[model samples]
Target: MGSDGTTAEVRCVAAVPCWVSLMAHDLDVAKAFYGPLLGWEFEPGPDRFGPYVHAVTGGEAVAGLGAASGGWGMPVAWTSYFGTESADAAADAVRERGATLAVGPLSFDAGRVAFAADPAGAVFGIWEGPLGRARRLDLLGAPVWIELRTPDPFAAALFYGEVFRWDGRDPERFEVRWEHDRVVLRAEGHSVAALAREQAGGPAGLPPHWEVSFAVEDTDAALIRAEELGGTALGPAFDSPYGRVARLQDREGGRFAVISAKP
Candidate 1:
């Protein structure tokens, strides 16, 4: 059970977000920019997907990058994938909740995978394999957190709760604090992700989306490298309870965050 009286029984059944992938119009430009900025080394994906590239850090696959093609009209951005016991079941649950399946419950050598968009239009994926689980976070270039910024935090929470079996009770359950805009999702008392309502007059031009944050040794230094690599800093680095954080956009305008957490 969870600490706040909500059941944690679903922790074993529902998959946590274990990987993130960035979709880019130009794969070469994406590689050139991220290779230096994040210290990511890329290798070709499995035989099924020829254009896919897996981002490796310290010899382990941490993320993925692939070309955006076909009728994929969304802007270039990172898509977070949750590990699931069965991608087909997860896809059914997403559809039952009124969310649209953007991709497939397609089979691969690694496992099954699918992409879906929430009712608010935030895209995410489901992965079923040992390779789909979250990698160790001891390295500086690993993802530490994922967040959803939507117009309706409450609705987003409810939607994810239904799909992922997350505890979404109101007032006292599953919140870091009642007044906090960010609602944290926990699995066995450990936070896995969060949903935040987009603030009025703040980056409203960007559509509802998921932002993946990678941990760094120094936020200031990382921000500098980002700028040097043709990326733009969305804002100056600032201290938070979690760490020093700054928002950044890739040269192609895909947004992400970097944080140097307090130890």
Candidate 2:
């Protein structure tokens, strides 16, 4: 990344990174959803890989907007891939270790990227960009968390547990937990997200999905900004035992969260 480039805050891994790609059914629709929700700025780019909208947060590319294809009969939503040192090497190592390969060791000069699923079936991405930055915080707090809602929690736990060398375990709620949750991970070497298995036949619209958490100074302010801007409030802003969160769908179908940890 050029110093003159928009990604100037390379120093604050504590703030936002560039944009995340939201996979949606329609390009403009997706943009409509996010444009105001997160208070993002979009840049025009070639329509090769997607209508390929560059969503700007804080004057830099914060997330991406793209049209979706088949990955299952799934519609619109956002998912993520981790940034790796050598995506090819990471993909090869994961595959050799029994993980299933989905995409490629192929290169993207923009970054070295690949897609794959862990033993438990949760997917993640890897990219060591030209700047070599992994996760950055913008309006979304550097993707502070990742949650996988899968049918078989234990199975998914066992798979990723071995693959990521994660300590997988279950603890009943309110028992004084140390980031206690299934599928625990360290974001930038700090504890970030956890995983949990959904009960069989759990309520509507829930499937094996990954939920990402971004940072916000005030969830209420962000929520107001989101609605006033044109994003859909998929769920009401709520407080959990964990943190304050508001779920949203950008113009298309890319859903992500803006969270603020309560002291």
The number of the candidate with the highest lDDT is: 1
Q: Highest TM-score, which number?
A: 1
lDDT of 1: 0.73
Give all TM-scores, in the order shown.
0.82, 0.69
Superposition TM-score, candidate 2 onto the true structure: 0.69
| Candidate 2 stretches greater than 4 Å from native | 1-19, 44-48, 68-74, 131-142, 151-178, 187-189, 199-204, 220-235, 250-252
**Weakest ten-residue segment in model 1 by summed lDDT:** 4-13
lDDT of each: 0.73, 0.57
**Model 1 misplaced stretches (Cα beyond 4 Å):** 1-14, 69-74, 131-134, 167-181, 187-189, 199-201
Candidate 2 residue 242 Cα shift, in angstroms, is 4.4
RMSD values for the candidates in order, in angstroms, are 7.6, 6.3
Q: Model 2 residue 120 lDDT? A: 52
lDDT of 1 by residue, 17-64 (tens): 777888887889899998887788877665355356777677666777
